[model samples]
Target: MSNQLVAEMGVVFIEDSEHHFFNARLAVNGKPFTSLLTPRRIRDFLERNNIVYRCHKGKKQVNEEKQMEINRAVARHLGCLKRPFQDGSPDPEHQYNMDESHFVIDLDDGNPLDFVGAQSVKYRSIVSDRSSGHNNVRAAKGGSNARILCPMLIFKNKKSSYPILNLPDTVYGVYYRSSPSAFINGRLMTEWLQEPRCWGHAWPFTAARTLWMENASGHCESEVEDTARELRTTVRLFPANATEKVQPADRFPIQRIKEHWRRLAERRNIEAIRKGDWKTGSASSGKLANPGKQLFLNLASECIKLENEEKDHNSVDWAKKSMIQ
Candidate 1:
């Protein structure tokens, strides 16, 4: 009989295709059924059996079947990259990741005081305003060997300046620019590609290196690829819809940076409170003001260090997930 017919007949003949569900694992020693049933058949079987899908921990909210296929693609891609050196293994130092992270300034991410079981809570900031969320600082980070390649900070303005008196940092200083949205663009990406500090850190000019980046519209533009070719660099894009699982930088650094930035924001808030900066005049008046652009710039420099990197992964097989933690 067709699998669809068998499932609809309620014969209990189908095992979960996801193969990760608790109930499915408890059934038949957690072994997947020999027959590969279509997702429609599996869904029908579950619905008929009164089984409902439960969100699993650490799993994204994508269609389970689609996620499974994505995982397979991730494994194949990583597996191909993991072959021995004689068979073209990637040089850890030359294998780099490039990505952009948008940061909001003068924003308090702290949870406001609320009573237990309250359905909702709201609090007003003494200095922060609604407009703070729209203004972003885009940090373009290049990393390899768990080290940052001196990040470039893009601010949301046609023109702006930093308050730091120092000309350059002794270690891992910053490169700054301006964009209307404080986000990356094709021109900005091309500019980054041509920066000597970026390529110089990896090798002599035109020395071959592997760059892993997302297939975003901006990065895939002809100009960006053309610039990379001039530098003797090869760009490999992350598999579609699988960056969360396969991107080392996305898989790790962003969370660490966000946490550190939060701490900095909190400390700044406390200082402001102590100095009565929140009090505009006779009393704390007006919206709470955000920290200046400098805070965001400092954040980019601190984020690319080895200590800030992901250090505690269980080293799950790369082919099954990612090559790095």
Candidate 2:
């Protein structure tokens, strides 16, 4: 099979099967044959010329230094919190860990085109599930179903050395606008601050206590810091560029929630398809509803609920049961 070369100008040229190189023209016009070259030169040039490869798909590590400052604050707060809970303790209350998570939602409404890999290993098109019967076949609308966001915090009982997880009310939070300002609102910041307060929740407490949090963009706010100072609560910050290795949420549970959430979304999509197929002419009295739209709404609702629950729990609960078991 011949390889196709999309030139810098996006003029595609199909090479002959016998030729390994797909002829690339340096310029779009003016003596095309003179500018013809092999793909090897282009590949070699791009490799040697490129600099500054970024991880996480070109995402810039902005505010990293400031983030470290927040981590330090969190660490200091935790130290204060743990003092009373220590064996020969000083304070017996107010300590916890808080962090956020990210997830990817994969839906089945629109099947992607197939692609062939090296050694002729071909990927197949995903077919819609049919277990629910003919009433479910619906057109795919390109969109996500849901996201399961969690702000997890852990609490401790100094007496028993027992720990409980404080989870928020909803599994995910929504951004009304794409701008950062919209997502980090007053309500969210308040919740983030209250996570270590041990406020209005019944749970065992260690004789000594401490509050801990990573330097997330949402939590590292001036307002929260001022509030912490006024409340007499200590905020401890982790070391710079060390969240991936230290934060419990980053280390555990967040990944599991995403996997579970994706499975749930896929299953819900299938179930919705089974319930709604109004186009099929069957019983005049029994027309199906729009499953695709309903699926999105349902998934969105679930995500919102999970996020709220997790947030609420972070502020209130002392511990949570492990989802793994």
Candidate 3:
């Protein structure tokens, strides 16, 4: 009966009666039963089942109509939908998906290892100076041609006194502290979109391009829209909470870049240990060396190169089914 009640709770019809039935079954078995279910016990059960709770405050709510509109807009932009406004959708080469992701200098949480009866373990690392580092990456692929734009890296530093000397000339570095959040703001977005390096090399002669991005405040600014209009690029905003499902960048490219970065960082740490650059000490005293800005640039560049090479191998598949294509 307890099992039956638990199974019923997993279904869609859980209500007061279900709870009462569960309690009655417990009472029949001469076990303690209560009128109200304990939240703590419920959470414990969920945790045992590998389910975690997250607070979804201030999340954008998209109605069915809005979602449908978003779908139609995306289809039209991809040349899959017949619409007068989208008569000549830009080819894949000219269509780009852009997004920003934040990475920390240190691991956010420690990894699990083979251990027995241990309360905790400690790993030493340099005190992270910058907790918020932003990378704005753009991925564009059309048929057999795929181009990964040189990413824009934003460090948490004053714009005037940013340490430009620490970075390589190949990677674009911006020193702007984002307010209230780790992501970039409207002014910075405009500045980045206006940069010649972003669009000049990819489509030098083609004025008409399409940019798909999430509906974040930074991406939806009036200035950003005006700049896109001036540059002859149409900006399309994805529906709220829909980027992970629709945006190609979010689907694979961004994740690949971060994975590559993690691997590179691990290798760098190993090399540092081998070279005695990293100091060894007790858990409370040890300090691990942090990769500098130049290393970050190198990792980002290598990831881009790797993705570009992989894209070449899969270009035929992409050409046939890619929405951007």
Candidate 4:
């Protein structure tokens, strides 16, 4: 008999196709669900059982996936910046990598224990936390909390303290802040370019002779192009989709930097909740409370040394192996 006929008759049978006899005891109604034994029979069983399955899509998941696409596009744009100079221009004596980053400061509205359980937000499972339920707003006051502050860091090749130039006549090489206004420009750019005291002697880029920069609107304007001409230096733009491979900031060390920033932010949040240190405005302000700035300098000066030393040791080992072969 066909398997379909056997199932319709509600009788259990075991038989080899080549064998004549079939034998098995069948239960008529004692089963909650049927189990299929054959590996190839899943579709048949599922169709017979009328089962339904569900999939979930979360907001954060969607946002992160979308952001990854955007990152790829941005990386491509940065890669294009590294192309050889088109005009066959001579290489410039100096070059710099420029970028901006954002930081945050938590504001207190008298809510210290504002955390809701993670799983509770999604209907996965319930985790009732008594501490998270407590209204501890009055407990977190006097915190040195305020608006966010952000500062741009410039990494240049070769050791020098050149001031950032301000070019009002032409729009190239203007530095921008998160705010609406330009932070640095014009004579500031010229002076900084000429001055060898500000950003000179920085590692990695400090040793570089040719500078590479992205084509930010402010940097690529005709005036800034003119400025580069006067300086007798060549500017090379990276190819699109290649920043992740070339830019030092996009390289391995950045993850370490972000991890450190997260640690600092968590510590500050704990401190603010425990003591009303800044509510009265007596706590440190401006440059002092800037966690991002502090972390960047510390990593640049000290932690980077450790990383470089390790890289050097690895390089030496690789060279020795190549010689042995």
Better-scoring candidate (lDDT), 1 or 4: 1
Whichever of 3 and 4 has more lDDT, that candidate is: 3
lDDT of 4 by residue, 135-209 (tens): 000000011221011123332212222332331212121221121222234433443444333333432243333
RMSD per candidate (Å) reads 17.6, 19.2, 15.4, 22.1
What lDDT does candidate 1 reach at residue 164? 33
lDDT at 126 for candidate 2?
26
lDDT, model 2, position 14:
28
lDDT of 2 by residue, 1-325 (tens): 1001212222223221233453443334565532444445444544565521122236566597777776786577557745654664432123345444322232222232222222332322122222211110000001121112323221212221112123223323221111122233333455444543223232233223344565556556777776666555556655545666555444334544444455555554344434443334443233233343224324444543553255233352112321101
- Which model, 2 or 4, shows the larger lDDT? 2
TM-scores for the candidates = 0.62, 0.38, 0.62, 0.36
Which segments of candidate 4 are over 4 A away from where they belong?
1-99, 104-192, 198-208, 240-242, 245-248, 268-274, 278-325
Q: Please give, for residues 203-283, the per-residue lDDT of candidate 3 as tens digits.
A: 433558777777788788889888878778788777665665566666566767776766666666545544556534444
Weakest ten-residue segment in model 2 by summed lDDT: 134-143
lDDT order of candidates, best first? 3, 1, 2, 4
RMSD in Å for model 2: 19.2
* lDDT preference between candidates 2 and 3, better one: 3
| Off by more than 4 A, model 2 | 1-93, 107-182, 185-187, 194-209, 275-325
